[model samples]
Target: MTGVTLAKAVKKYGDVQVIHDVDLSIRDGEFCVFVGPSGCGKSTLLRMIAGLEETSSGQIHIGDRDVTGLDAADRGVAMVFQSYALYPHMTVEENMGFGLKMNGHPKAAIKAKVDEASRILKLDDYLKRKPKALSGGQRQRVAIGRAIVRGPEVFLFDEPLSNLDAELRVDMRVEIARLHKEIGATMIYVTHDQVEAMTLADKIVVLRAGRVEQVGSPMDLYADPDNRFVAGFIGSPSMNFLKGQVAGGVIVVPALENRRVRTSVVLPKEGATVLVGIRPQHLTVEAGDSSLILELRERLGGVSYDYLRSSTGEKIIVETRGDEALPEGTAVTLDFDDTKAYFFDGQSEQRLR
Candidate 1:
């Protein structure tokens, strides 16, 4: 296993900066995931780490070695691409041993490595099958096994599960989690899926438009977000943003009861026009006040209900247990639990209180 460090790493396509001096250190054997929307430069950053793409400036270190000028083959890092990149004509065993063969490893050694990888991935029965003969999940496993046979210090996965079906994706995700525990290799995964990042990562690095937005554990980013963008982005259905300001020690929302959405958090300053973010799960829907109108309800088993806040025309999804159904346009009370609410400064977008 190897720890990776990127110091002031910058990537630019001519003048367009794709990565803005990112400085990050990933610990040895840690499963770190880089997560963001499309065009966020996540893949570019991963390629840089793999040495498939060069950094515009700064340094990259793997374990104790400086590898900024190294080629992909010499970086001691194996990358599994989103496309799988398997040779269609080659059998699973051949594909897994291809890297070793190209590097001039002995046939017997290659066979041993392939056999070991096949056992780990449970692909022993499918060794002679070509890429076309295997299922999507199996093909992905071959791709992963290929990386495994290389015995790299660090592993890079660029949305390796994106091509699989929903059920297959879940299966592969569990498989990958198990693989990490079994191998204990340093892994850097890039994905746009929050569920993937949340479930797989030991630490998640959230990126946006060439900048690192936040880096933390899933619960840290979910429970205590650094900014409004992070607070909204990390959670499913997202947190609710209400237009409010501090008035006489109370967060005053004109739409709620008593013309105020009160909170216990002490305002850092007065006359601050801030956005009050309350997660959908944090809002209590009750038959108390009149302003809270339930626009829609999506009941998905015993987990929760997704209730759209009708009062503000904002899509608010509430998580509640049981088969409780609130009809569309049902007027109800919305209570923002003080302990769960987060205040954000309007201009800076920084979290307040």
Candidate 2:
């Protein structure tokens, strides 16, 4: 297995540029994920690395050799796409071996590789089954098995689990994680789901508008985000942002009943408004309070998410344990540890720290 490096990489079609000057490094045997919303150029960047799309300028190096000008087939990388793309008439065993056979490898060599991939993916029993007979998760495994048979230096996955159902998606996420541990290959995965990025990646590249926002380990990005976009994007339910105005190094928030938030982070000029971010996990509500109303409650088995709406229609969500239900119109007061809050510049939207 080998690493991948992109230096000053830029992609342009005519005069319209979708990918900007991006530089990234993926170490050997590392599982890196490119994550962002739709049209963020995550897929286009992956395609460029795979040699499926042309690089208008800059360089891409796989391990020690520069593969910028190489063809897709000559890049020593195998890709598993969103669709299975399996041959309907062929059996699982035949499909897994087809790539090697097309390259004119000996039948014996192809069979040996297929057997190994089957064992690794636990598809030894379904080798003779066709795509139509396999479950969605099984078909995805076969798609992955096809890539594993090639023994590429790097493996690229383009949202391979998006097509699966919720349960199947979870199951395949585990399977893909296990596959990486067993093979220890350099793998790059793309997905908009932060849950997948948090659970599967050793490193994550957060992108937006064709620009790389930040790159770091899952916990590093989660616990300490550089900007408002990353702090909101890395966590589930997201961090809440409340408007406030600075007064003598203190932030006064109207939503928290003019609560004073004192943080060590440098404050802007007095009376300058800023943003205070707090995760739902850190927020709690006091029943029988003024202003804030319990708008809705979602009972999700072990935990419940309570949605609160202020008199001004500002929304806040609180995650609490147990399945207790709160009345829709019940009055409440928002409470949180002031030290746990994050301060951001209102105009630039950057972290104040």
lDDT of each: 0.87, 0.93
lDDT of 1 by residue, 200-241 (tens): 999999999989999999999999898887888887877887
Q: What is the lDDT of residue 271 in candidate 2?
A: 95
| After superposition, candidate 1 runs with Cα above 4 Å error | 258-269, 287-289
Candidate number achieving the greatest lDDT relative to the actual structure: 2
Model 2 global lDDT (CA atoms, 0 to 1) = 0.93
State residue 187's C-alpha deviation in candidate 2, in Å. 0.4
**What is the C-alpha lDDT profile of model 2 across 1-353, one tens digit per residue?**
99999999999999999999999999999999999999999999999999999999999999999999999999999999999999999999999999999999999999999999999999999999999999999999999999999999999999999999999999999999999999999999999999999999999999999999999999999998988999999998888888899987799998878889989998999999899999999998768668888989888888888888776667888988865566788998888898999988999998998
TM-score per model over all chains: 0.95, 0.98
